[model samples]
Target: MRVKGEIDAYEVMAVNPYKALIVPRMVSGFLITPILTLIGTFTGILGGYIITVMVQGSNAWGFMGNLFNWLDMTDILGGIIKAAFFGILVILISCYYGFHVRGGAAGVGQATNDAVVASVVSIMVMNYFLTTAFFGFNI
Candidate 1:
């Protein structure tokens, strides 16, 4: 949402809401979302590492090293591939609900709420199916 009459990075970067599949909204989302996802992944990894270190206590580095060693180039590639779909999910959900902000504060508020809710749900659902298809890892 724009504040102080200032358009967001998304607003400036997003394409006109109607064009093709890879429009500005999608492009911006694709660019920025991986960073957010990486933060979440790293935070989760750190928490798990700390817990393993404390609970297991004997071999924290060894465990983490082994887990990370499994994350080869193909694993990173798969993650990047998944992130692209997540970005697509976010942009489509947001733009689906948020294109008509000119409808006023109430409309904008509802749209923002819907955007967040839809993005989250879409990501969760898409992640499950995509991960299942790509790695057969049923999350």
Candidate 2:
């Protein structure tokens, strides 16, 4: 919309661009990431079951039995927490870059590229700290 002057039209109507634009995305990312992570976790377990029990002919009972032993609530919660943080980081960074876009389509492309790079780098750095905090600094 910034490229097309839609945002300017919104401002002429006294609409708050940040609220209309960034907040929804931030909220959506904060809420949806955990949900998607949960779904992915279940699907991953199911896939593991398919591979181990069905494909490899391992005992289904054993797989099911040891699953809880190997995977705990802490691990799952940690993943969900990580997903939430990562989602927020990605959305906020993208929004920042997007809002600051200048020039034209080329600027949008550049902002997008920069946002992806920044998001990835920040996520990696944040992951290390989060993991250390969650699991503790053993070293």
Alpha-carbon error at 86 in model 2, in Å?
A: 1.1
Where's the lowest-lDDT run of ten residues in candidate 1?
1-10
Candidate 2: 10-residue stretch with minimal lDDT: 130-139
lDDT of 1 by residue, 36-97 (tens): 76777788888888888887685877977898778777666677778978887878778777
Measured with C-alpha atoms, the lDDT of residue 49 in candidate 1 is: 84
Best by lDDT: 2
Candidate 1 has which clashing residue pairs, if any? 14-24, 15-24
- Model 2, range 15-118, lDDT digits (tens) per residue? 99999999999999999999999999999999999999999999999999899779888989999999999999999999999987887999899999999999
**Residue pairs in candidate 2 whose N, alpha carbon or C atoms collide under 3 angstroms:** none
Candidate 1 similarity to native, TM-score: 0.66
